[model samples]
Target: MKNDFTLEVYSENAFSVLNRMINIFNRRRIRIRSLLATELEADYKHGMASFKLHTTAEQLERAMHQLEKLIEVERVVRIN
Candidate 1:
């Protein structure tokens, strides 16, 4: 049921945003298979966090929705 998601965080405070996202997963008890953050090569000023979690589809959707509401987050989308 779990899926991969690519999150592009646009704020200057990218580290803070990543921390908050980790907290979100922790609080929800979602076990993450892989969580990686990398600076976007095209947009040198921005960063992207890629997450692969072990969770249900509904739970993933809810988490993505919540992520989109964060101030430091730019966009949340499930990757194919």
Candidate 2:
């Protein structure tokens, strides 16, 4: 069975940050259903990225783990 997952990532607004996130999904051949990115605060350089993806629970967990390991990533949460 497949599960729908929403990942919220907080990180610096750097190209590398977005690249790393996309790479994680690409490496696993997972397609993102939707992606939204916005700046966290006007005074800060941090941003938030939200991604909706459909995949197995195991793959979701693995992706979450990899996201947390990135230096640019401050936090990661699964909305559903």
* Top-TM-score candidate index: 2
CA displacement after TM-score superposition, residue 76 of candidate 1 (Å): 0.8
**Stretches of candidate 1 exceeding 4 Å from the true structure:** 1-13, 41-44
* lDDT of residue 46 for candidate 1: 71
Candidate 2: which stretches are off by over 4 Å? none
Per-prediction RMSD in angstroms?
2.9, 1.0
lDDT string for model 1 (3-56, tens) is 544444344345577888888778888887787787776656677787777777
Per-residue lDDT of candidate 2, residues 1-80 (tens digit): 67789999999888778989999999997779999988899866899999999898899999999999999999999999
Clashes of each: 0, 0
- Alpha-carbon lDDT, every model: 0.72, 0.92
